[model samples]
Target: MGSSTGTARHSFRRRFTIVVALVAAVAVACLLPRWWCGRDADQWYRGDPATVRGLAEEMVAFEDDDDRWRAGGGADRVVGMWGLLAHQMTALGLAQVSLEHPEWRDRYAPVVTRAAVKSLLPQLRSEFTSSWHGRDGLAELDSPDGHAYLSYPALALGMARLVDPAFPPHLAAQHDALIRAFERRLLASPTGLLDTFPGEAYPTDVAAVAAAIAVHGRATGTDHTAVIAHWAQQVRAVQIDRDTGLVIQRMGGDGRAHDAPRASGTGLAAYFAGFADRALAEELAAGLFDQQRNLLGFSAIDEYGDGHSGAGDMDSGPLILGISMSATGFALAPARAFGHREKFTRLYRTTDLFGLPLRSGDRTRFATGGVIGNALLLAFLTSGPELAR
Candidate 1:
């Protein structure tokens, strides 16, 4: 009996050893590419407009067919709306890159404007309702918490104005109507900050919508200072992370902070805050970097770097030992905008390693990300003072 028990123990030990070795091997495999990409991505990556536009054209080809984007939902509820919006945001980013490359104007400009001029919102609303809110779906635009979907149309119009000076008169009218709808939803919020869902809100959505508002104002020479001021004050009083000064992730309808500060949410808000308010954005970005990122094998953010752990959700993808894949990827935008070049490069390296880049002829994109990953990358790579300027 003793010999039999000893043999069983030996078998268990061998299995455990193999498991640990496999885990270590996988970690090394992932990090090795990141190390290489960090040192060598310059071969394919650059800050130039034409270079970025090349990626945009690829994204356009991969994402759009017959002037329509693919549907954006699956088992993951958050992926649906976020994935849907990514195409538009990619279009918006493509337009931003076009600012420096007039030759590429004909490729992405008309496409973005067409989606805005047409009606993608109703489809987005319907999908968002079914995927997230279930079969009942959202009944009214104001009632549901998704005003940020308007951001793409707002930004597309903004970009159209910058690239194509002849920006269609009818499209301009459509832009005005969209702004009114946004204003109506903004007014519908019980709190000054916009709601992302009924009775629940995230400051990221507010910042994004505020950015669209700023962009629209720039495009049309409209002043929305008063609304912005009030909204900022409201966010400060209720949603700003006291320790980090970044926007808090989740809040109740009564304007009470719900979750701890999270990088995935705070990072995106800081990225957009550049358009609405730059100084505050700088502070938020700096604080978020100091707070969340752990620079071990590669720079990665924690789901809640403040003594919390939970299962991976939509916002915070696959959390492993507190590290978030989503936060690490999405965190790039604010890192770049805040001038954290080292941190930004680290995050980008991580993205490059995980993103699975695919190239066809002169164009390249990360196939694993589909449009969602590419759009986020496009936004990050193109991010700077240029959008706000």
Candidate 2:
């Protein structure tokens, strides 16, 4: 009996060892590609496909903080604007990720769809609709500080349609209204330098207006190409820094440029520029890419060392001593699309190895800073030709 028991124990030990080895092999297989596809992670960065794939994963995982449904109460609950934006973006990114890496599609599709509903669908149908209160039409969902808050949602609606044709029509209609509202706010001026507030004005608003119009054009097929062209010209006139070919942030109503070129503005501009003017877009985006150092710092100038220190804004998400990976992701996608191949590849490869925050089962999330904006960045990175193109 003792001999029999010893033999059984030996057999169990052998089985356990085999299982351990198999598990280790699987883990290595899963993680090896990511390491191999790592981006440069220094200054003047470029991007690569493998690295881009990893970035997509990073963007994909960036939606974890938006899991506030339980915290917000339940199904009909909502996380504020920022959180809402992230979830929408995450969903869009996941859907796009599904298309690119079909191996992961089945796993991500439903999750992305849910994330979208959690983020945008409810808001569009319920809160931001014409039926919303304010005693009828006295106070509509106006632009925030002249920035088209509707642009992201409009982009989300358009993306939803792209991902799933069966997406609701009301969402599309809401998107259309949002675009019209943007036109009313920004396009009122011939230069298209949008006012942040309805009556308040600024030259930097041109870039914002241009961006919103471009997104609206892309999303709804509204043929805003001419409108976008006008705004693009205005954006160039206002945001372009002649000294370094970098795009500046925050210009005044009197057409004066802000202190310096910011990562957020340059990154955001790159997207519309890629679609409208690749050459100029590349020039502007090139200033943001850092190839040799594997780092994409926040500002083109004045952000070196401890010069600029701060975080938590609607534009720049949680700057780390000034290295804004979130802004880097924003700039990288458009830069790649606009033929900044070297810069694109460097950004892609270097950003791959790090910045993924969580992994639940096969699902992952980046969740670096803001609850919502990160999700939108993920969506923007994942969806459309950003990764595919």
Candidate 3:
């Protein structure tokens, strides 16, 4: 009986050892690609010009084909929004590179110009607005009835002008008009927030409007100091969440919170605010950083701050263990902008691990990231001080 027991024990040990080895091998298989892809993650935040150039070149190539954006199984509104975001982000990224590295200005100016123009295409706006609001977003831009989303394209136009002062005269005029319209409406609003759609006021979109005005001022030497300052003051007074210190994700027209303060909105708001108000941007960044989670050297921003928990929606993307995909992704820009080296590196490693980067000669694109994802990554990775002057 003792001999039989010993043999059974030995058999059990052998099986356990084999299971352990299999588990270890599987772990290595998963981690090896993450480590390999993320080997140079720091190069991105460190402003390696060659790294920036490669991604920028890839974005330009992708944007060159308008037909590449097709309405697939997803809703047309979602696809259109992605297409618009893709173009706006591409322009912003290229413009930022031109501002930071003047040596590349000549090569990227035309690309920036093309992206800015494409963002304003009526068909694109119609596709998005018809599905979302049952009307065109670009229509009646001068009306104060809340077309706050237009601020994105306006900001792109302003960036294009900043990069190439010789921007076509007509386009330059349109940029001026947009700046004036935002200024007039913002100054006229009692709560200092504008609705992105009817009855839907998002502080993030309002932040973009302020950024658009500020960039337009820089590009044209226009004085929007009063407008920006007033908007910032109002934001601090009403739009910020008392508990989290982050901007409220969604607000009513009266600046009342419609949803929780979330990292996705806060991170993007910080990126937009960086162009206009450094202090505001930094404040938002600090709040956002407080919500970050680090595990095994990988960092992700939680969608909700401490004391808040919520399910994922369209804005937050999928939530994995409460970590938000959009929040984590959007946080990259502010992480780099605010000089969070460790955080940026870890977050970027996470991105590289999941992004599945595939490289060709002088070009690299993330296999999982289509045109919109790639463009947004380029923008977030390249984000720095506008005009770096």
Candidate 4:
């Protein structure tokens, strides 16, 4: 009996050791390839626009429902809309790039614009008009918490305007109303920076306000210069991390700074560049854009650099740690449009590829995912801003 008991104990120990070894081996195997492939920054820029365009189209085609559009199969969500809109706009920008590389433009622009109008636009408008009470003069959107869920729609609206000029007229009244809603519900005193909402505020959503403000400035060409400037100053005072050039993800209405820099917040650097110091935008871009890896590896900061933290709310989609293509793409594209050439070039060289070889529906899906990627490439293709003589 004693011998039998000893033998059983030894068997259990052996099994446990084997299990541990297998687990460790599997983990290393999974991580080793990524580590090996991740080192080459050049791998990021597989700059074939035709391939990129095809990916964008695939993303749009994969949308089984008007409401649901994620890169991988997922439910219809806000980020999908934002991602689609940004993707279409990037394609329009890429048209100029396709001018030189005519092969890319002929394949992408027609389909991209078509997708924008037929699919992306309608969903965005519905979200604005129906889901949110923006059209009903109900300043704040009707969400569970009673906020308009401003950032995502605001960014989408801004992008849509670029895609279709008529979009602004259709939504103008609502647009102005949304702005006023922001003022009444989300604006905080002293700083004048808007919050996610009046009481329950997200510190970083103020950047969304900044984005809306910048869009208004560009779209209307008036009434926004001073307002945007003031908001940018107020936002910078409360949220910017001077040392790292990152911004706090959120702050209390009472004006205390939190310590996390969201991709959305950092991404705004390029959009907000025109209103604030150009150098600051450069700093923010540098701190935020990690060009060292591919899609799964290129995310921006989640709250507190939490390894597995994500933007799962209305503001973002499933986040893979260490890279945020969505955020970095948004930042780089706008930076390019606004004439931050050096930053644009760096981002372009580092992150200029999308789903290639046609594994999916349309290449614009990759374009949508890599909106900044297209934007950077487009900027390279377009004429540069003239320097002071």
Candidate 5:
């Protein structure tokens, strides 16, 4: 009986050893890719010419393929919205690069123009209309009734015009019309808040409207100071959350919060507001920075502030242990723009680990990120205060 007990103990020990070895092998397998991907985090945050140029080459190829718009994989409305965002971000990134490196302007101009044009296509608007329950945001531009979401395409067009002074005349006129429409609606509104759809107002979208108007002013020398100032003052008084200093995510048409103050909205709002009002942008950036979380030399942003908790929505992407993908991704823009190099580097490591980027001869694209994801990363990584300059 004693010999049998000894044999049982030996069997248990062998099983435990095998389990330990398996666990160690799995850990190394997981960490190896993360370590390899993070090696260039600093270079990405610094906007290395080789890295930026390689991504640009990939974006140019993406724009050349007409079917790329449908690659997002969802309902038709989701596809359209994602496609529009992808094209808008692509155009903005290319335009900013052209402005920063004039030597490359000629090479990128055509792609930028194509992206801006595609952003305003009728099919995209049709999808938005369906999703908005027949709101037809592109219609009634002269009316003060809502539809502030149209500013997205307008912003893209303004960026395109800045890069290519000889933009198509018809599109240039459309861009001007959108700026004037937004100016009229904003000045006429009592609350300085405009609905993106009927009864649905988002401060982030309003911020984009303000940015589009500001960019139009930059590109065409139009004066939009008073309207922009009025919107800023209104946001300062009502939309900002006193506890966290982050902008409330959504509001009613009467300027009351419909949702809690959150990082995803605040981060993107900070980026859009930078073009119109630097002070306001800085304030939002400060609030967003307070919510940063660092673990093992990697960084992410919390979707909710202290004393707040909620589930992830379509905008926040997903919440993994309270770290929001969208919030972390969008925060990179403000981090780069505001000169937070260490923060940017750490956050980028997180992006690279999950992004699964694949590089080839003078070209790189994130394997897990389709066209929209790649376009957004391009925009966020290349963003800086110099883009406004």
Candidate 6:
């Protein structure tokens, strides 16, 4: 009886080991694709120029569809906030693409640049439509002193200058006017920042506008050193979050910093701030790194640095295991820009796994993301040297 029991136990052990081995094999098979695909994070950054062009081409198509949605399907089809920001970033991406591949100007000028100017520029201007408010309600984009609409105009026009010397002279005139508007807004601000929604200013948006002004200066051989110095000082004085030491999310026009640092605003502001003050950009990025960095396998950013989940908004998108998806995705731009290669690589890998990309013919897009998401992704991937003087 004892011998029989021993034999039976050996047989069961063999079966158990076989089952364990099989399970292990299956797991490896399932996980290998993700590892192989994502092992090299820079793969996305090394995209073909033609593919980059296709993203811009595809964006125009998507924008038309969005307009149609607003016109026919749902009054709620309106895009706002981050969506509008992507509209501006898309145009900025196209501008950078045109600059990097000057030989492709023939294709870029009319297809990307002019199309962007015609469609998205007006959207950013918010002509009778609302971009700062919710989709259900049309909030006018008419903050005279510190309007958010003013940010992208400066960015798109400054980028337009890089696209072609023959870009319309009137556009350049418009660029100067926008800069003047920004200057007026800056001088008028009690807090030294510009507002996106009325009475609410975000450091990220203001930093972008500041960078655009600097880019325009470089493109036009005009010096904006004095203005930038004053503006940067104001930002430092009022925008830094005491807890995290990075830029805050929203400040009142009366100058109260409302939220602690997060990946979304800090990343974007830092990327653009590099144009005006690389030092400031570096400082913010360093602070962000100390607060947000998660170095286990794929890098992730905590939505709030001090574990404070103060409030989650559409801008933060969905949080994954306490990490903000939008913050992680959007932060890729500045992270890559500032030479945070290891972290950038990990973030890009995460983006790739979650992005659900689609590729056909010459075009590649993230299936799960809308026009804004893809546009922002394109902006992150195709970023090149600055036009900054």
Per-prediction backbone clash count: 1, 46, 0, 26, 0, 0
Shift in Å, residue 91, candidate 1: 1.8
Model 4, CA-based lDDT: 0.45
Per-candidate TM vs. native?
0.78, 0.62, 0.87, 0.53, 0.87, 0.81
| lDDT (C-alpha, whole model) for all candidates | 0.66, 0.51, 0.82, 0.45, 0.83, 0.67
* CA displacement after TM-score superposition, residue 154 of candidate 5 (Å): 0.4
| lDDT (Cα) of model 2 | 0.51
- Which portions of model 3 miss their true places by more than 4 Å? 1-37, 67-79, 131-137, 386-389
Better of 3 and 4 by TM-score: 3
State how far residue 43 of model 4 sits from its true place (Å).
Answer: 12
Across 1-389, the per-residue lDDT of candidate 5 in tens digits comes to: 99999999999999999999999998887777557757887777777788789888898888866645456653333356787898898998888778767889999987898889888876776755876677665666767776877888999999888888669998888788888989998888777788886777888889989989999998899999999999999889888899998888888989877889999999889888988898898898899989899876688899898788888997888899878878888888888888888888778888988888899898899887788888988888888787432
Clashing pairs in 1: 145-196
The superposed Cα distance between candidate 6 and the true structure at residue 209, in angstroms, equals: 1.5
Ranking by lDDT: 5, 3, 6, 1, 2, 4
Candidate 4 local lDDT, 1-389, one digit each (tens): 99999999999999999999999998887666445433322322333545444534443343333334444575444343454444434433333344434555545445434433432344444544453344422332432232434544554354344334345365655665565555444443565444344343454455455555555545565455555556557656766655555666556565675435566556644444422234445555555553223333332333223332444433434455545545544555444444554444444433443322214433432334344333333332231111000
lDDT tens per residue, model 2, 1-389: 99999999999999999999999998887656544544233222332244335545554454333345456765433345545556656665666666666676655665565565555544433333332331212135363334443454444454455455465677566656766766665555554555443333433334434544554565556777666666667666765665555555555544565445566666665654554455556665665553124433212212212233344365655556566655666765665455455545545453443444444554344444444444544544443344321
| Full ranking by TM-score | 5, 3, 6, 1, 2, 4
lDDT of 3 by residue, 304-325 (tens): 8777889998788889999986
- Highest lDDT model number: 5
